[model samples]
Target: MLKAIIMLILGLSVLAAGFITLKRELSIEAFSISSADEAKSEMKNIFNDQRWFYLSGIALFMQFVFQGFHLTFEYFFYAFLISSGIQSLFYLFNKKELDYKVCGVIIVSFLVIYL
Candidate 1:
């Protein structure tokens, strides 16, 4: 029972962080391009940008490290939550999209909570 409560708190905290990251990402200025070609060009430019790659790499690396370890459900739950929070921090600081990262965090959180 105590473990369950702790898991709930950790999960909620991570989810909240993910939401904040999403909010920050959405709050950024939307790009405006008159033509599809121009938009594609701009998007490509953004996609190839080093900052995005670095952020994504860090997030992925953290996920790998968290998942690779053999941990109890409670530990995994707490570690994932903390990792998600860190990822959210990365997004918040770097202005990167949260998207699937948030989803991954939520799914793992629930799995750990119920398991």
Candidate 2:
């Protein structure tokens, strides 16, 4: 019962972290443009940014982690693996630097969960 409760809390916390990161990185208020073309251009620029892919990968990984914790470990192991791989790929794609340390902790946790 305590494990379940803790899982629920952590799941929710991961989801909240995802949302907060999204809000901070992609805030509409920050893109105050006077023209439609400029708005479209800005949108295109934002989407084209490598951070978008990095964020998407992170969001995917975190979402899987949250769902995995909320449900059963056996069921979400593949999902966790796929999402974690994608996250790592995105991180690698974002920059040549090896900055995939963030997903390392998540992969380790999921490995523990798998065992």
Model 2: per-residue Cα lDDT over 1-115, one tens digit each: 5435534444554566566668868875664679999989988985774643453455446646665545455445434444444444444345433355345435544554444
Per-candidate TM-score against the hidden true structure: 0.34, 0.34
Error of 2 at 57 (Å): 8.1
* Residue-level lDDT for 96 in candidate 2: 32
lDDT of each candidate versus the true structure: 0.56, 0.51
Model 1: runs farther than 4 Å from truth?
31-78, 82-115
Instruction: Encode model 1's per-residue lDDT on 1-115: one tens digit a residue.
Output: 7656655665566677778858978999986789999989888985774543443344444444556644455453465454555455545556455565545554544454455
RMSD (Cα, Å) for all candidates, in order, is 8.9, 8.6
